[model samples]
Target: MVFQIAISFSQSIYFPPSNSSVWDTLSISRLGWCPDKVNDFYNYLDEQQTKSFILLKDGKIVLEKYFGSFTKDSLWIWYSAGKSLHSVLIGIAQEKGDLNINLKTSDYLGKGWTSLPPEKEDLITVRHQLTMTSGLNELAFFCVEPGCLIYKADAGTRWAYHNGPYDLLKDVLESASQQNINVFTTLQLKIKIGMSSGIWIQVPPNHYFLSTARDMARFGLLMQNKMVWNGNPVLRDTAYYNAMISSSQELNPSYGYLWWLNGKQSHIKPSGPSSVPGPISPHAPEDIFTAGGAMGQFVSVSRNTGLIMIRQGLSASDDLSGLDLHDLIWERIMDLGCITSNSASQKKESIHLYPNPSQRYISVDIPNTSPIEAKIYDLQGRLIQKSFDPKIDLKGFSKGIYIIAVTDKSNNLIKIQKIILQ
Candidate 1:
């Protein structure tokens, strides 16, 4: 009986539209984009290091594409972009009355909070950690050398991108939740915002954020929505969101929480373990913020345009240096207002596709007692094929990721899970 119910549920699953008309209707060029600008950016990305890109404006997807083996559902690692997730979750926790940033790290870890000289250890607060000003000695956090790991200064007296300070936040969150960071993130944030398939650490091999580029865009939208989803505020505080978006310290105009700032020189080292790369151009505004990852994974949020652009892939370098891509994205964003009118209506139906990681012969099941429209894309938003009825076969397809979105008579939207053919 349980198997029957499970099969029925699978048979009735619905897929939504891949692109929202609201975003398609906007005049993106007037907002500052030159004609064929996206193509130019895409070309550069191909030349540089990018696998997937998704652009959302005002809660609608403007542009989306995949390169190489990526797709709408491919779960690329977020690298340090995960740091921004840490900040936002902390904000949510504080608003939920679970923890306080004003408290010392000592409050959670107690004596474990110090490897430092006593005076310095006592002064560090959770707030200081959030701002990267905990002054916990760069060498201690880096330095492959052993004796090099000693506290050298007072807390909050300097700025350093030490991973230790950030890692400590995981402990703080866990202490408050009595659960691991993965569980906390899943229950409190991901599922609440309609993200069901996200792994916080260890993607395939190593611990990393494993999520679709679309889901990353959704995360960005949730932030853009101010933690509100489906008319409800999922995050506890607006002030926290504001702070996350702004410069958290006077020492860095380009750093906030664990996210990266786009606009000015923040005295970043750019080469050492603590180094943060400066911008490539001066025309870039200081108002932009991004969730940066090790590869080329980026979720850049622009305050000027209410835009969120996410790019996921391997950027083939070591030191943090990828300003040109951000610049190109902004140029495309300048074309975001009063342009075209998309004639597509809201999709209000449901369709289902199954055996997602199929070796061959995938199936589609629709509930309507009536018919539904379905389209399949091969990770790059390119139409690979279309299916009209309940069952579509994929016998000749290669192994990769694909997205199946469905629409009904009224044009409602539902995006289904990733189909992996391995």
Candidate 2:
């Protein structure tokens, strides 16, 4: 069964009129952002070869700027960022009863779709492809042919960012829906949301999507609103939507259905060995998720701040999928809204985690507070346990990693730490 995450939030986001070509915009100052910081943000983005940048608040454009000869109408490739779009199409197919993500992919693609034997190939599922857990080998060049789809492990036992399996998702959608991808997207997504200027370009065995910056922002808004277009329910499959945004597996907590999630205790980079010991985007909001391409193409959303940040252009960051540049942009964006107080900044937390890779229990050197409480969360951001005592017990709990959050009487977050159990 799909875990149903409970989140309570109400935001009346502004939606552009369905028949109009114009968009409603918000001013930076009106949103409490200092006007002077705009230039500094621009300078950083410009030096990194940024072509276009757009920031939206509550579905309204707040900051939109184009660099060099690029304009609002310029078309830019989303590269691997288009993976998220394919995820959306897959969701649509599931909703229409055309396909089921839990079913074996060979059920739709037929046997011998992969280099593996028929029985081994049938073990792969649509959900595995969505979560990047097909366990396919990532060493070879990008080729979706059956000969190139070599098996590295059984599906879902491991998570690896292999493009070979992902690129075939388009073929799966075509076979299941019996309709061209462009026509399906136009009818199911574009017309409902009034989005224009997006098209898919196929290069040999790979597919790349291109669209204007505004169109990217529109796509962000659609997902930000839980896949609802204005008053219409575009993909009313809330279970799939939740699975798409929440952590898909324990191996990489920072990934969700082809999207890069921001807030998790630990993460594994694409094809990286072992697990990195902290949140992927440490400086950004814990709830933010992103869709990105090579260089710096991105579409990021943070429901906590009611923000949708987008960027496009070339860059030198070797960290493929544009994660490096996007994190830098978020750090600067966090500084835009307000000023900092030196007095409060000087006070650092006294808490510390001992025997970090502990096996049983742990303690902290925390300050006193009225009704102080400690909470534990899984990588999916779900609350697992809580305590009122100083010493927290971990007996009987599965061996892995978890996030500990301590709060005061007024519900103020005092400290957060990532702890491991071995």
Candidate 3:
């Protein structure tokens, strides 16, 4: 458990009035960004149906753009991105002695919250739910009922991304704190960080936090400073804060507690635990951690560069992980030739496969490696074949989904890419 120390900010760090609309902003030209490229970026955002976009450097707004009828004060849903907010609230609850994350979740939700037997269910802890390793059937996904929360594996053994387990976190917070989640949010977090406008609204199976884009920026700024707002300690627990931002488990090094981390050696998505060989946003800073949601809602914080970005939009892609939108934005921003805060982003190893969804044969390209050995596994994790080279012939295999696990000479996983045979 690595603890984080607060970063002391100079007077240049600006904080807005707690109840006012006034904010300090820095010009793009002053930041040495190409004026034409900055406008083109706004055009790209508009073309992508972005409702709002906010960029901050050193706590001062750099660029804030709103599209269509969405004004600066318009409220938008954070969708799954709201999970990061709960992550912070959970830390606060622990800090106040209201709950211990290691305790059995059943201690608060009461026994038989899931269909699993008490002995097996007792194996789950609040931390398991926080990290999305609850071992609950991800097929149950949005269903939070007891019968839907059946056992899939022992807790902490498998890592799966699903919302049913995460949704219960609100209940845990409400139960442990003995207060309504909204009330707790306002008192413990929202007001403390000048983000009082945000509210959790239930839209059936899933609950979302609705707030303005600037309000989202406020939260991101708070996180960028390691949970401090203008030197005011919003979440004073340094250990929990560090743990929340750091990798929570090994199954997905790209994930923290409801937050997506960049620069991990490997990453997996909602598709499954088939690891991909790079950070989610290859064009972004390695220290950029993200909280993203369905469609295109996200808050990305660059711990190394003091950059905080919030984007709210609609995406046509079925990527619930929001990886596509996050990467697209960074790809364009990095191409702007304005900032080189993290130049090492250019050298990250990203996996590429040729003619994906092929029926006969496939070739893999993994940069800066030799003798790219691969293991082909079925959906049930049964190893079907092994290849000494980077090519795989799917002649005898049926048309279905498969996982190609790339490993080092020692058989340790270096990458795993899910491919389709058709």
Top lDDT model: 3
**Cα-based lDDT for every prediction:** 0.62, 0.79, 0.80
Q: Where does candidate 2 have its weakest 10-residue lDDT segment?
A: 1-10
Alpha-carbon deviation at 62 in model 2, angstroms: 1.4
lDDT by residue for model 3 over 138-193, one digit each (tens)?
A: 98779999989998899998999989989999999999999999999999988788
Clashes of each: 28, 0, 0
| Alpha-carbon RMSD, each predicted model | 18.6, 7.2, 12.0
Tell me the lDDT of model 3 at 68.
97
Reference-based TM-score, model 1: 0.66
Q: Which parts of model 1 have CA positions greater than 4 angstroms off?
A: 1-35, 140-149, 202-207, 264-286, 321-325, 328-422
Residue 84, model 1: lDDT of: 86
Report the Cα lDDT for candidate 2.
0.79
Question: Which candidate leads the pack in TM-score?
Answer: 2
